[model samples]
Each structure stands twice: as structure tokens, then as C-alpha cells.
Target: MGIYKILKTAILSLFFIVTVFSCKPKKAQNENLLLSKKNQLKKAFRYPNYLNKNYILGKFDYMNSNNFVIVPKDLSNKKIYIRKEVLVAFLKMQTAAKEDGISFKIISGTRSFAHQKRIWDYKWNSKYKDLPPLERVQKILLFSAMPTTSRHHWGTDIDLNNLTNSYFTKGKGLNEYNWLLKNASKFGFYQPYASKKEGRTGYEEEKWHWSYKPLSQLYLKYYNEHISIEDITGFDGSKYSKNLQIINKYVHGINSELK
Candidate 1:
């Protein structure tokens, strides 16, 4: 009996030591990982300001800001703003595409909340005005984002070449589209609104819209975690935001590859 008791005590002690040591390391590792992620986000994006939904919602002024740069007139049709990191990647990609004889232009770029609001309001008060709020918003959402929920607000997305789908179906536009498909990812760009047939959510297939995944993906993660449909307000059809599942179905409903 004495021998058995000693063995049992020894086993219990060993088990306790193993459990304590194993649990402590796991806890410490998790804490360290969380701290690392926080630090990385802060160092890379300037923390809460850039990661915050207000920034994602286009509440911040990007004009003359160091973080944003003007798209050179040669690259875009009009004066447009784009994130510095995205511009760098795009410039590199543009050079490569130029070499390949597949040239494209930025038709649209960063849009502030006020700018997007103007777009939303214009369509809202247009012929669609007669429709129910939700239906009217739906019509706009098919192609446009409802102000605050737009990815364009992030400055990491752009519309390239032409806006029409048929434009990319053949000829020069098709060549550009095919080139983007073959190589855009090499520079961190991806189509966020691929065809529904690809199982992507949100807006219809916008062959023109390409996002800088490296930055936009992180911004999207922050937006999904922090922003809610209720946070979307100050627009004509703002009330319909929740019913439309704008946060989930629109803002979060990007290309899975992006997610």
C-alpha cells in the first residue's frame, strides 16, 4: 500500500506540472501574438485612425495628405486620389502592363463620403425615387455602394479602363482584362466583384473595379470587425441599411480571395 501511494502521488504531481507548464506557454504565446498583431497594425497603418471605420467610411480628408497621392494625369482621366502604397504597386504594375502592350487607365479612384453621398443622392432622387426606399437602394447597390459602405472610401480600390461589362468581353478591353487576370495578383490587385458564378457576394461583376488587396484586405478586416450597419447613417436611404444587410452582404461581401 505504501509503494502504491507513492507512485500515485508521483503521477499526480507530474500531471499537475505538465498541465501548468503547457497552459502557461499557450497563454503567453497567445498574448504575444496579439501584441505582435497590434504592433504590426500600428506600425504599418498608424493604428486606430487608419483602421477605424470612420476612415473606412471616408470621414478623413485625404487631399494634400501624405498618406494619399494624386493619380498622375497620365494614369487617370481626372484628378483622383489613391493610397500611397496602392499607387506604388499600381505604378509598378502599370509599367509592366505598358511593356506588355496592355494599357489601362484609372477611370475612378478614391471618393470621400461626401462624394459618394452625392452619387447616392443623385440616383436616389432620380427616377428610382418613386420606388420603395429598400428597392431604390437595391437598384443603386447593384452598381454603387451606399455612401459609408463603399470600398472606394478606403482609397485602395479603383475603376480601370471602362465601366461597362461588355467592354471587357472582347477586343482591347478583353485583352486588358485577360492581362489583369493573368498578372494583377503579381502586384496585389484583385477584382473584388467577380461574377456571381464565381460565388462572390456583393455588387455585380465589375470587370472595371480592382482593389489593392494588401492594404484593402486589412482595412476590410477592421471594417468587418468594428463597423455595423447601424453605424451607416446620414444618407437618404440610411434606414434601409440594416434591412439590406449592407454590412454583411455589401461591405463584407467581397471576393473570397480578398477575405
Candidate 2:
């Protein structure tokens, strides 16, 4: 080939390669941005009614995800129900644990708003009497207050148990818990308020509280953004209380990490 033609062809080839490579990254970046935008939009408006009479704790909103499968009434020794995606992941985790002689079980899944209220009243009247009303409300806000705010109201959170005991406490370490820590993310699960991160969450470290990965991310984002003092009050307040004000300060001012 002529020298001029050879140089021209090499330049064109290089230009084509560079253009294609550059375009690929741009395409990927656009896709990522689009996905992030979608997530944000979903988070902005996806608030569940924690006080709805029909709200069932531990029961999956099966309509929300196509991957959900009904747990066999017989196989689930307990009446606990979970999202199909969560069940699949849990079963897989169980199978993997058995290989190492570990067994896993579900102790608590969902709770009705009424049930939550009862617990709240019991706890408040029995254990938190010494706390100022405002402080008590602030503390419960970190977790759930019956008929007002509860992740368990969403049916995506689960309280798992070791084979020996279901109630969670310090020194109740089990291989299943470790396995979940390492592998639950693969199936879309995470301990949202891990004991290690208690300071940030303002809640007790719950080793057994695992959320379905996908929905939890959405809920966390929503919980961060939508459940403002205003929103919580709107849900169930007869009058403004000091506790509500404290909750607002933390939720709106400090814990504003929602994406």
C-alpha cells in the first residue's frame, strides 16, 4: 500500500477503537445514573401505612414482588411468613448451614399494628417509666411505636433465631448468624441496625433483625426521607409531645443520610 494510505488507515482504526471504548463507558454511566434516579424516585413516594388495620406483621406483600412464593403451611413449623425472595434466600442459607452443623429458624416476622401498640404500651408502662415521656418516645422512635412506625409492619424484616433459642441477647452467637453476616447479601438481606452500628441507628443492636435486601434498601431510603416528625405526627398524634420533637431533631437533622 502507498505510505500515505497506510498511515491514514492506521489513524482511522485507532480513532474507531477509541470512539467505541469511550462510548461504552458513557453508556454504562448513563445506565447507572438512570438506575439511581429510579431508586430515588421510588424512595420519595413509597410510604406504607403502619397503622392500617389490615397490615400484618411478617406477612409478605406478595403483590409487591413476582419472585415471592407462598411458604407451605406444613413445612414452615411456625406460622411465620416471609417474602418469597426472602424464603428462597433463607432456605439456601439453611442448606449451607446444615453442611457445617448449624440450624436456622425464624422466630418473628411480621406484627400487626395492634400487636405493636400492645408491646409499646407494655414496654412504656413497665420498663420505661423512669424515663421522661419525651425520652421514652424518642427511644421508641428509634425502633417502633405501635400503630405508628415499625419496619416489621413492612413484612420485609425478619427476626431469625439459633436452633437452641429464639430470643436474641448477647452471647447467643451462632454459626447461622455468622453465615448470614457473610452470605445473606448474596440473597439480598442485611442487618440494618447491627449492634456495632447502634450509635448511628439510635436503636438496640438486633443481631436477628434481617431485612430483605431489595425492599429494605427502598424502605431505608423512604424511612430516612418520608417519616419526618411531621409525617409521624400525622399518622397518630393527638397533641404535640416533647418526644415527637426529639424524634424530629434526630430524624431530620442528624440522621439525614437517605439516598
Per-residue CA lDDT of model 2 for 1-259, tens digit only, reads: 6999999999999999999999999999999999999999977963555422233322335345453444544435567656666677777877777787766667766555555667777657776767877666656555554354566666677776642223443344655677777877776677755653324534545666777766655654556544544444322231444344534433222222221
CA shift of 13, model 1, Å:
14
lDDT assessment of candidate 2:
0.58
**Candidate 1 per-residue C-alpha lDDT over 101-201 given as tens digits, one digit per residue, 9 for 90 to 100:** 98878989899999999999999998588998778988988999988888899999999999999999999989999999999999999999988985666
Error of 2 at 146 (Å): 5.5
Q: Tell me the lDDT of model 1 at 131.
A: 91
Which residue pairs show collisions in model 2?
57-110, 57-111, 58-109, 58-110, 69-84, 188-213
Please give the range of 10 consecutive residues that has the lowest summed lDDT in model 1: 45-54
